[model samples]
Target: MKHLVILGAGTSGTMMVNHLIGKLPKKEWKITIVDQYKTHYYQPGFLFLPFDIYTTQQVKKDGRKFIPKEANYIQKKIELILPKENLVKLEGGEELPYDILIVATGTNIAPDEIEGMDGPGWYKDIFDFYTYQGAKALRNKLREWEGGKLVVHITEMPIKCPIAPLEFVFLADSYFKNKGMRDSVDITFVTPLSGAFTKPKATKALHYLLEEKNITEITDFNIERVDYENKKIVDYADTEVEYDLLVTVPTNMGDALLERSEMGDELNHIPTNKATLQTLDHENIFAIGDATNLPTSKAGSVAHFEAEILTENILHYIKGEPLKEEFDGHANCFIETGNGKALLIDFNYTHEPVEGTFPFPGVGPLQLLKESRANHMGKMAFKWVYWNMLLKGTHIPFVSANMSTKGKHFEKMES
Candidate 1:
């Protein structure tokens, strides 16, 4: 039987298993997925865990639960990817050969990339909500804390869920206000970018929210090191931002397996065809989600969309057909602005997020670029959708893999 091996059992890999299991002929092929962890985290929920909005139990579950019984699941650390030999070496030195390989081994926080960031202050005064441990620790810290300078920071660009740091401060604003300590906590958002976000329109809208929430913004601050001794962060320009509590999203890089194989870019992200989801170096290998160096948001929504497109391309490859250049960098994200409000942004490679109705043109139960209680409800409801529909590879109704621009008000580009 032909073997198809998938690296990583996270959102993207799990969805691919679900999507292709029914499509690929079972009599001729077998599928196997590998990962080191037993628990699968609802990463987006990590954003809410610190403020007591979501409990530790609510954010994680058995990784095996979502994976189908028919597909082989291996719980072990990946040692290396021998792409030339079409073999994967596990930690115990066992090798698995494959006819096709799909890489969904996503990116992770690299706090050690910055000096002193992961030293004495880590998990004491410095914390990151990107992991379950960090989120839970920050929760414990926030519970008893009287509050002081709370700095929400981003180390660099292309981090997973670029909007999450902003969301953290917004929730911190609401969290403190609810506790009657809004006046006691001082929140500052520090980023290496020139603005609150990468896109101009979204940045303008988010910048307004930062001002409205009275959260300070320190832009273009490229961090050099963390002065754990002085309780401050220093940038390359010698600028310093002091803080009592520092919650940072450190530099995100892909799995070390890519680095071991020498098949990845500087950040360890595989160079992939942005449109076809195929790895540039190998025709039989494919990549999706945060594993690829795609110029798009590294969010779950983008993974969901890419999974759909990649599935089609994989099928074409099996039949010795030309792969479809269909994926357009589509991404949908809900920006939680706290106080029971959020803003939804939908865009693709050629489009910036504009004010538009989603799913249905000019007729949305959800509004784009506008904060409302309804959007917040939609954001909350997504957790249920993620567990039930998204990972299962069930296509969301009314939402296509490609972005729709019919109802959007786009500004005219200067030709």
Candidate 2:
């Protein structure tokens, strides 16, 4: 039997398994998925965990629960990827050979990349919500502490869920207000980017939210090091931002397995065909989600869209057919604005997010680029959708893999 080995059992890999299992002939192909941990985290929930919105139990579940019984699941650390030999070496030195390989080993926070960020202050005053441990620890810290300067920061660009840091501050605004300490807490949002977000239109909307929430904004601050001793962060330009509690989104990098195999870019993200989800270096190897160096948001919605297109491409490859250049960097995200309100944005490679009705043009139960209680409900409902439909590879009705622009109000830009 031909073996198809998947490198990770996260959202992308799990969805791919569910998508392909029924499609690929079971008599001919055997699927195997490998992951180090048995617990699968609802990463988006990490954003809400610190504010006591989602309990620790609500964010994680058995990884094996989502994976199909028919597919082989291996719980062990991946040592290296021997792409040339088409073999994967596990921590115990066991090698697994494959006819086709899928690398969905996602990106992770690298706080150690910044000097002193991971030192004495880590988990004490400095914390990151990207990981479960950090989120839980921050929750504990926020509980008894009468807040002072609460700095929500981003280390650099291309981090997973680029909007999450902004969401954190928005929630913090609401969290403190609910705690009756809104006046006591001082919230400042710091980013390396020029604005609140990468997209201009979205940034404008988010900037308005930041101002409305009375959260201070510090832009273009490229951090050099964290001065743990002085309780401040220093940038390359010698600018300093002092803080009492620093919640940061550190530099995100792809899994180290890619680095070990020398099949990745400087950030350890595999160079991929953005439209096809195929690794540029190898025809038989494919990559998706945060593992690929795709010029798109590294969010779960992007992964869900990529998984659809990749499923088709993989089938084509099995029959010795040309892969479809179908994926268009489609991403759909719900930006939580706190106070029982949120904003939803949908965009692709050639389009920027604009005001529109999603799923059905001119007839959306959901509105784009507008904050409303309905959007917040949709955001809360997504956790249920993620666990029930998304990871199971069930296609969301009315939402296609490619973005639709029919109902959007697009402004003409000068070339």
lDDT of each: 0.94, 0.94
Question: Candidate 1's residue-wise lDDT over 217-256, tens digit each?
Answer: 9999999999999999999999999999999999999998
Off by over 4 Å in 1: 412-415
For residues 61-100, could you state the per-residue lDDT of candidate 2 as single tens digits?
9999999999999999999988889999998888899999
How many clashes show up per model? 0, 0
Candidates in order, TM-scores: namely 0.99, 0.99
Clashes of 2: 0
After superposition on all C-alphas, the RMSD of every candidate to the true structure, in Å, is 1.0, 1.0
The TM-score between candidate 1 and the true structure equals 0.99
